[model samples]
Target chain A: MAKTIITLGREYCTGGRYIAKDVARALGIKLYDKELITMAAKNSGLSEEAVAASEKRHTHSLLYSLYTMGNDLPLGDQVFILQSRIIKQLADEGPCVIVGRCGDYVLRDRKDVLRIFVYAPKGWRLAYGKENNMLQAKDEKGIKDEIDKTDRNRASYYNYYTQNRWGDAHNYDLAINATLGHDACVKMILAAAEAKEKAMEG
Target chain B: MAKTIITLGREYCTGGRYIAKDVARALGIKLYDKELITMAAKNSGLSEEAVAASEKRHTHSLLYSLYTMGNDLPLGDQVFILQSRIIKQLADEGPCVIVGRCGDYVLRDRKDVLRIFVYAPKGWRLAYGKENNMLQAKDEKGIKDEIDKTDRNRASYYNYYTQNRWGDAHNYDLAINATLGHDACVKMILAAAEAKEKAMEG
Candidate 1:
């Protein structure tokens, strides 16, 4: 069987991490999520916390660009470049499910990769967050604001680094609403992966 | 079986219309495509040609909006509202497939409807258009431009009326790349529809 790499891009509270775990386990393949941060820390001299912090500091501001001018690539760019190399390395190593970190754009030239974006309605995501105790806010509005901020940061991070928009359908082979349930979403992705493998073979 | 309404939005040359036909036929339900224009024409006392012409006129320009200010709704808006009403009427009637004319937005409040957006890489779409004799342009560049113009018009049309951005993953339940092949794409949508039905039932 040929390698089929799946890059899963997701919104903040869509149970996307859980779905990625299930998919990797189902396919008997490795999963790369936060491990990319660790790998980047190892490869670069930066500590894991620094690497993670760099990612969180959104770089979309014109003021930020001006601040970083004539300096080494901004911290976020350095982290992104390092992680992109690691993502490509992982894809080269074997079939795996990589969640987040702009894997879609890193592997854009590859024929064997299936790029997927996972999202759900805001209400559904908010409920998931509340049920999972993932919310940092005490009230519904505050929680909703947290969720939107996270999504905005993600879009900002992605937009700053890539030519493509983060959640645009054109950038992905499949963009699925996570309201479909994790099991069903997994099945659909696996089916698409199989079809993709067959297409590559033919 | 409960009714399942499928609204398909497509980029040019993605074979989305054919897939819509297949899905409708397989489900033994009616498919609404160009039939929408005829219905709108009859209900609005306009000719089908007139309605279609209005739809193609592209109402996204600021000047256009300014020109129509404090006046009757522009011809495009009038056509769109009429069609939206017809879309709601048809969905109310029974399970069916509605393609294009922003059916997704028209029936946004319905839980039973699956909003799908279909697109393909530009190369694939161009190849499909050439093979099908769907292109009016004689040169490859000309044909590519034509394809882009069509997509731009669609995005503009969709953006002009709906609060949601066209082609944003948030607006649709599923967005599939047509490179997956029509059969695979159809099967995926059917699977999603079934999952949605079961979810709704529960």
Candidate 2:
């Protein structure tokens, strides 16, 4: 079978991380999140802490951009280069489910990449955030503000780097609303990913 | 067959208009593009020119945005309201394929709507633009520049209104790369639309 990589691009507090974990365990495959930066740092002579600190912000780190663009930043060119490199480095490490960080466009057109974007409604995301301790362990208003802030940061990072809006649905092979339940989201995505790989094989 | 509405969210040069025409002919349904503006304008009591002028610009003009945080200038909101109304009105009138102006989110959750997004790679889009007289008869570089600018405006409009990014891929039920050839795209999407409608009925 061809090496299959499943990348997850998700909305904040949508249980994207949780679902990714479930899918990885279900498939008996390694999962990636902050771990990607560690692998990239190790393979690319960068630091692990540096990778974590940067995370999605790594898409436009000046030193990396300079190396790619040959000189000073020229408007939008740097973003593409940074995103391209980050995506390449991730794909280079072999098959894994990457949660967010524009792995879809980075590996766009790769026959082996199965890109998934996970999101749910506002009510569901807020509930998930509270349940997962993503907020300050508070009620609706408190969590809503935090969720809004996180969603904005996520959107900005996605927009700045990929120049595409995050969670737009068309960018992914499968878009799931985890509000139905985490288990349900995992089931649907696993089905899509497995079938995609099988189809690729035949 | 029950009435089916096939909405077209297209790039400026992807032959979405033509494919839509083909779909309407094949399915014997109405097709709406810029023409819907007149219908919306009539229904909303705005002038046709005003509707067309605001066709895809969901942003308040620069001056309007400078004055407030958009609580006052309902220009952007107004465009969406108009688009949503028109989309619903069309759906109610019977099946139609709406092109552009954030129709997918507008019709989302509708038991009947099969939203689609059509896209092509840079080279293919440029070629389509030139072939379709959408490129202002420019050289490859010039056409590329125009395509970039046009898409930026489109993404800005879509992002602003839908709170979702244009061409993001995940938002649509079906997305296709039209670089495969216009007729092929038409055939595949027509089939997809039919299949999707069947699923919805089931």
Candidate 3:
């Protein structure tokens, strides 16, 4: 069987990972989320935390030498190069669901990939965050703040990597609203995958 | 009555100008299309031909120094400055249907503006273009070719100027398939405008 790669981007606590996992299960393929952090760390010879920190963050310093006289350190450039390598390796290995890390942009030129963005309303995300203890954010206010920061970080990381705006439908093959519920999103992705396969075949 | 701005973007020869006239008549307001070209030229002090040539084309080199040099130079910059002035003037004049030149993006940040994009399929556009003589392009092939080029130019110019991609439903307040017919699009815009007013009032 041929493999299909699906990348999911979601609002904080919108259940993107769960939805992605369901889709992966339906398709009988592996799911990748935090697993990428370990893979990227191992690939780049960097600490997991360091790789995670740089994960969805853009490095914007072409003029860094102006600040450092003799240092050639480039936080952004190094992250981009290492991340590209890891992402390529994953594709080379097998088809899997990738959450965040600007995977859509990273694999833009590839012919055998499907880019998906999952989003929900702020209210839905907040409710989900509150329901689940996964959120370190304490209250509604904290949740809002955290989501905003995460969104901004994700947007910049996507824009920096792709030179295209994130969540813009033009940037992705399919943008699914997870607010319709996680199950619905999974079904949609599965259907979209089949349709994409047919499109490619035709 | 407070003044409002309605920016109409339409596919070639879609009876957009006619529908705009109807809206202006219904609301007892002014309508400007070609008049905008005149205003843009007058406000920015450029020849009509220069304004016409550069009207909806994206040169995309505002911040680049190398591209900014030449005699009678900075055509893009001049068009940019002119667009800004015309948009401001139209908004101030109030309650008008200003067509094209990416007016949607110009009024994107404004609360009092309604942005609409209208499009019809190639066959419909060609039939209308031939009957109306709105396009100088002869024959179906020529008409289709011109439509494709013009639409592309609008998208590129709109994206370049506003940093937002055109034809993305997220960017516009509303998008209309003029294939539903020009009159339907007009009615849709009017309905949308009415809803917007109710929202503002509530």
Candidate 4:
């Protein structure tokens, strides 16, 4: 039987990375998260900071450069292309759980891929961020602003790169609310993966 | 333990009704689909045909009349209001599985409700329609048109009534691809509902 690759897209502070890690550990497969950026940097012979900075740049500026510039690709585009290549290469290597970086779009043609998106209600996400001390803002309003900004950036980045809208259920095999808890989320993904594999075999 | 109300929103030809029936059967709960229309019609003292017609009317015409009309409620709005009342009453009675007719929006305030959206790829849905002889049109193009129209109407109705966008992952507890097979979908929903119950208890 062929390996099933799982591509996960998530809203910030949804414990998505933790879920990804757990799923990978349970399946005994490679997990790619921030590691993709490092891989892309090595593949492109650029500094890791440069590749990471490209991702952090506002998408509006990236779009502006994409449309206005001549044949030369924008720094963001160059990094995205490199990362996409790396994602495909890793998927070709074996079954793995990849978080974010538009792995769903990059592996759209693969039959063994299960695309999942994780999100949570605003209040739940806010509370999780505060509880985990993951928020950079001190006050409630500032923390909300930070959360909203991060989500907006992620959406913009995803929208710019993929034909399908980010966070839309149609693009994924499963879109789960993270408030269900990490264990439930991981179990659901595993079950879905097994189901996908069985269906493919039949 | 309190009953968990499951509100399902699904695309055309996704076998959403069948899934609802099976889930309700497995849980030994009442399933509400077309029954809501009949209940609303009885409550409003209107003919069942009139209530059904109100739902089938194009949303654009409904919106136009809604904006133009003075104080009098449009037939569609009246039917919707009656259904909303019936839905609330049903919830008060016991746990049930309600399919479509914006049940998710109606039960949005409830703590024990699980909102699910089921969809399948276009090719899969089209094939399902043909195999089941569910499509009104004979030719492939006409069948495609029929499928598109039904989905469009459902989305328009949902978008018009709810604050959230239709088929958006954020609005649903789980948005699953029906291609995963009905059994897998059912099991995942049951698992999620169990997880939700445990979380609430905690």
Candidate 5:
């Protein structure tokens, strides 16, 4: 079988990272999430923290340039370019599962690429956050606010960087609600991957 | 409390109809599915069978017009217009769960409308079909071809009548994979509805 890359974009607290891990393990492929930031940081000669922070919401290019004025590279553009190059390199290397950093757009021209978006309903996300020690919400309002803010950042970052809409199903080969549980989401994605492979063969 | 209309579009044999029924019952609201055709048929002065047949694949306006040439009303258009009006009327009346027939597009302008698309992995849909006596595929290939043909027709009908893509997450407030089972799908949608309502309130 030819190499196929799976790019996953996920909502906050959706266990998307965890699910991607399982998919990579099951498919026996490399999983790139935070690792992409590290690789990009190394390639760009910048700190990983700087690249990661650049992904947060409302971090405009002006503020980033002011911080790294002497470096002569806008943090946002630097991160995106380096990450895009790394994603393409990874895809060319072999089959892999890449999580976020607009991997979908980076590999958009590749027919062997499968783009997926993972999201969970608000309540489920809140519960998952609390149980996993990923977030602290005193009440439903707190939970809602945290999710809204994080989702806003993610969506803004995605929309700013990519031509396609962040969570639109038309932009993805598959969009799964991980509220269905990680295992089921994994199975469905695997099935989709298989179907996609078969389609290529035919 | 303001009325909220839940519009559901589903892939064939995904048990979307069953999920919508459970959601309506849980929320104590009216459910509209095939009954829309009956209502549209009565309102359009056409037989329910004719309206239903018009929904089938390859049943183009040209073919339909030949069957009812003297009437001068294409069956597809007649059904769409009447069904759209009925959907809007039902939304205005009160909170309800509407399944298929482009209910999402008909009620697109309403703030209280929650549009959802339900889909399932091929394996799950095939199993559900065999178990529920909805399909009698001799093998996976048969099952796959049947699903592809049915999905193509539904997509065409949806794209023809609606401004939005049928299963796009951007068009719908939520999209789900009923491979998680009917109860889970209902619960997720209910949660989503509650969250949407709360968001509107704030």
Candidate 6:
């Protein structure tokens, strides 16, 4: 039998990562984040650094890049295809929580997958970033620039690979605000997941 | 003839107001913001200050507040009812842009209404707040707190009056990132509005 999975797509500094961790723990399911890099590296025969770097920015012109490279696939394409396979394989093996990597689009056809998008207002994210030292930049302007740049890259990557718009609520089973705090967000997601499961059964 | 109205719901510091203004200018339509308070105050027989105060906080009890005050209605109920009427009247009168006041829900049944939600990543919002001096709070933390609190009040007010979840994509015809800058966002909204109009006609 196939296992049910939950795929989370989140905005930067939105507590989406924390929510995924808590949700996975609560549900007693394996959670995949950076681990997907290792899986992709092993599966695609690429180095871990290559897999990790692909997540940083969207590579332009698969055709031009691929033609020049001659048999070496673009890191973005390799990571996406291999990691997508890993995601499917993990789902087939057991219930799991997959964070980011466009898993929502990857598992679009799966009846057992529950896709969620977690987001919050910008002020909340900014405050969280400052309090946690999650940001690389020291000053507020520099920090904001970094956050904006990172968000843009993520959006570009997701848009490049996915059929659905990133962060659009209609693409997911549920969309929540992480600014409500991690515990509250986790409870809400769990409750929503339960509701989705029951609805599927009913 | 009915007007083609666009209602914008947005996150604080997301430049939603600027987008609304630009959209209104592009469409050559009236933009309702503080003006709605004037309309509600005039119609509800409440002072402008009362209407403005009601906008700031969610009224806890309409019936209880009304009963205790003897002659006064709950600010929430009064504002909601009066503003809803004014929204409808504005739409009926001519094409206009309405921001907040749950204008989408207010005109949910109207064929000519276009609902849009504008959002931006948190860091971008903080930057915008700083650059424009739009935030009353001097420090970053204070600004963030005010933004969060104001958002909570807005969400409570919207959720209380509307059948749909505030900020949920399903409730909107279009959801956009204000980080695209005002001009791009305005163009996108205008294009979407035209597409919607064409769909209606076809």
All models, DockQ values? 0.80, 0.12, 0.05, 0.89, 0.11, 0.04
TM-score of 2: 0.57
All candidates' TM-scores? 0.92, 0.57, 0.53, 0.93, 0.56, 0.52
Instruction: Summarize candidate 3's per-residue lDDT along A63-181 as a digit string, tens digits.
Output: 34325634554544455557766777787788788877777777777766777776665776778878877578787788789988887887776666566777665455555444445
Can you tell me the CAPRI class of model 4?
high
List the candidate 6 regions with Cα displacement exceeding 4 Å.
A1-3, A59-73, B1-202
Q: lDDT per prediction?
A: 0.84, 0.68, 0.67, 0.84, 0.75, 0.73
Q: How many residue pairs clash in each candidate at the backbone level? A: 0, 12, 0, 0, 0, 1
Which residue segments of model 4 deviate by more than 4 Å?
A57-70, B57-70
The C-alpha stretches of model 5 lying farther than 4 A from their native spots are A58-73, A136-140, B1-40, B43-99, B103-202
What C-alpha RMSD separates each model from the true structure?
2.8, 7.8, 10.9, 2.4, 11.4, 19.4
True-structure lDDT of candidate 3? 0.67
Residue pairs with backbone atoms closer than 3 Å in model 3 (clashes): none
Worst 10 residues of 1 chain B by lDDT: B57-66
Please report how far candidate 3 places residue B135 from its true position, in Å: 12
Q: Sort by lDDT, best first: what order?
A: 4, 1, 5, 6, 2, 3
lDDT of 4 by residue, A68-178 (tens): 885687666777777888899989999999899899999999999999999998899999999998899999999999999999888888887885688999999999999
Model 1 clash pairs? Answer: none
Docking class of 5: incorrect
Summarize candidate 4's per-residue lDDT along B74-124 as a digit string, tens digits: 767767767777888888788888898788889889888989999999899
> Per-residue error at A127 for model 1, in Å?
0.4
Cα deviation of B81, candidate 4, in Å: 0.9
Candidate 6, residue A195: CA error in Å?
1.3
Model number with the top DockQ: 4
Error of 6 at B85 (Å): 7.0
- Higher DockQ: candidate 1 or 3? 1
Model 1: per-residue lDDT, tens digit, A1-202?
5369999999998999888889889889989996664675566686656676666746565345646674556665666767788888889999999999888988988988999999998899999999999889989889989999998888988887775688899999999999987877988888888888877887
Off by over 4 Å in 3: A52-73, B1-202
Worst 10 residues of 4 chain B by lDDT: B57-66
